[model samples]
Target chain A: MITAEQKPIDEIRNMIAPYKRILALGCGSCVAECAAGGEKETAMLASALRMAAKINGEEVIIEEKTIDRQCVNEFVIPLDDIMEKYDAVLSLGCGAGVQAVADMFPEVPVIPALNTEFMGETKDQGYWVESCIGCGDCMLYYFGGVCPLTRCAKHLLNGPCGGSMDGRCEVDPDVPCAWQLIIDRLSRFGALDRLEKIYPPKDWSKKEGCGPRKIVREDQQK
Target chain B: MNNVSRLKKVLENGEFAVTAECGPPRGADPESVVKKAKLLKNNVDSVNVTDNQTAIVRMSSLAACALIQGMGLDSVLQMVVRDRNRIALQSDILGASALGIRNLLCLSGDHQSFGNQGQAKGVFDLDSIQFVRVAKNMRDEKVILGGDPLSSPPDMFIGATANPFADPIQFRAVRLAKKIEAGADFIQTQCIYNLDRFETWLNMLRERGLTEKTFILGGVTPLKSPGMAKYMNNKVAGIDVPEELIKRMEGVPKDKQRKEGINICVETILRLKEMPGVKGVHIMAIEWEEAVGEIVERSGLLPRPSFD
Candidate 1:
């Protein structure tokens, strides 16, 4: 899932200070699962903005609303009527959702309240770890379900770099050496021979490096 | 392969080759590299110009190699996969070949976070193994990465680095084997302070007959001081400086530590000369280029072989 965290309140406050009427929007999908831009977070953010405005002797009117998924245009139809009422929208959705809403409401400014982090999984109640980079091409099967492109700091394909020691990455001790994890996983499954075949340089044009990417599915299109 | 590398010729003739490193200046001045190259001109077979070693910015290795080549010294163009993508890398390889640089040392450089620039995005477009294969393909197949024919392919010798001290010790030799299979003609390792561990790695190579496939050059670096030893042991990743070696450095007087370090380096080189599968010694002076000549001379590798 795409994980994100709320931006500092002061920065968010400064962005919305220019407008008197503000809308704190949230998304109920990926960001909601991570407890970042959910319904409760949107309400709390709205309350905080109101208190901040009261302390500053401002007359800012902040309202809260959340959609099932802000990335979807159908779910964003509810905001069409209310978006005209606000001077600016402080979006608590992920980067994609923020841009989606901004694309829909071309007039009002849509400011993001959260920082999009990475595509990762919830490791624990409060901890999250990145697992994928959405590199467009996946080679996890040969690596025994571990993605070296995303996990390894250097994205080494042949084997581990020399910095790995005691199964920990030299870049950060807290992070496990991705190649070690790959080696161990493959070793356990008796698939260690899979690494004998060298993987070539990745074609990064498939990713966003080249430009904006899109998938046109004629079968699924209206 | 049309081997144009002088270093490869030295190794092929059954000579114990001696190579040293020449780090480029942070500034754009060519004189600084010339000064270091002058010190190592007649003392070693070839000099390796590091490409921003440790991620710290320096003059481009290709330009530095050209500078040293003008001084009548062979140069090993150290190419790291950290800063360039496949296009830039292949272009630079051709550029070096065009400028008469015959050697290449392919490496996945130190992470950018370790360098002065923490915010720079690392461009590991090709890992070192893939880099070796790419350079090999460009040289042997006369084709670019996409299989398009190169008008003139590079006739270059390829080198790669190995760290026997890193974790999963048993797999270090296997990694070296992968590099050799990827067309690495020679291997230069991380600086060696623990001979037993190095021999253990070499034994693994010998067992797999990898020793016969490629030339192996043991790496050595003078410590300079006890603090430097401790820094390498604690701070430097992939380097193992034994505690006894540090104690030996600390055993000497503060003013004499540099001399002691050189002595230890010379001793290590002499020992490496006798080890099986060890074809040569690469002295990485690490900003102490003047000491390279003394270390090499004391190890009795003087009067470096020259082919007219």
Candidate 2:
């Protein structure tokens, strides 16, 4: 599950205070699993807003709607008609979904109610921690199952720095040292010898320093 | 004592308290919510604004609490740590306190798998017990993340949840005790339909001498119909509807089932009120707010204690 945290209600209210007709749009995808943006959350948000408006003596019209996948164009196309009914949309989807809604309905304003924190998995029932950064590359094969891109504060690809103390990151004591985790995993897999194979510095060209990256499968092309 | 301490005194006075749970709407229209709040304001002692009840998105809980406060009604802002980190949670608590929303319910909400969005991620930075402890720490220390002294520590009535009917009732009680030990001032249990089982659990509390440590609020929700009962039992975990109640609901005429449901809820509340260690009632009408007033009235719980 992608761990997501909801934006403060007062901040959300202030953002949409000017709008009379509002649509609380939920994405039935990542945000849904994280319990941040989904159909149920949409209804709950609607109910809370209705109560808030009543107490504030504000005349606001709110509607609730959810899409299968707000990040995809096909999923968002159907929302155009519904978009016409509301003055603004409060999306419970991730940043991608919110952008998709905005892209599809440029005429209507779209606001994100959740801060799309990071791509993560639920460690337990309600617990989730960051795991991947989708850097268009997978280095877990060399290290371990853990991705240094997300776990390490510096996103180091090599060994742990001197800042590591007792296997904990110096930046945040609560956070475990990512490189230490890598070493442990490598040792468990009997691949500790791989550590001697010094890796060259990462090439920034294939990553974020450059403009947006795209991948095309030659076989899938017409 | 401060305002919050005063509220705590009110609760400790053995007053017949009434609390209503308000689920925010999915969209922006606040009419239905406002109507529900208006209807509940005069009848209940405090109104609970749920935060993403059932993991569904709606209006924000903080905004709803602020709105309820603006209407001059006591608002209990429900906070679910499922989607927030410790920093965010503490920050929100401070913000809520600044907004004059003193009452808070710390919950580890339902898993995302229960909702329509099954693949969404969950952020359980801390469980209910950890959250309650954090709240207590904040109150006692008056310092946040950077060790900066708070301008004014928030005086909040920290609340937690317990489900008496949850499978392995012993574990549930243990968890409840942990929450209390973690600094839960009060506990609001899950909806109850089986009074005998609930009473047995209450007896257990008495046996363990936990009755005096925490204020227990019995949860009551009126079944709108047989379908509603089935949905809750089959779909919602830790919620059980007795076969006899189901049969009674099924036996009732379709048009009158809602009335019967209200009656059942009222009877349960009346029974629970008479039981030992039950501080008050937390009425969860689920989408049927109109019936709450009727249930409270019929249960003879009207004209509740005035804090003023």
Candidate topping TM-score:
1
Worst 10 residues of 1 chain B by lDDT: B1-10
* Highest DockQ scorer: 1
lDDT of 2 by residue, B1-308 (tens): 23453335557887867888898888887776687799897788788989887677788899888787777778888998667867799999998988888888988766555565667777655556667777877787887644678888887888988878764454345556667777788889889998888988898888877878999989999998999898887656567788889999999999999999998999999898898888888999988888888888888888777767
TM-score (chain A) of candidate 2? 0.92
Residue-by-residue lDDT tens digits, candidate 1, A1-222? 999999999999888878999989988999999999999999998999899899989998999999999999999977887777898999989999999999999998999999999999999998999999988988899999999888999988876999998899999989999999998999999998898778888888889776888889999998
Tell me the tens digit of each residue's lDDT in model 2 across A1-222.
555778988999999999999999988888888888889988898889889999999999988988889888999898766676899999988888888889988889998898889888887877789998776667788887888767875454543432455567655668888877887887789886665443433444466656977779999877
Give the DockQ (2 decimals) of all models.
Answer: 0.81, 0.02
* Stretches > 4 Å off in candidate 1: B1-3
RMSD of each: 1.6, 19.4
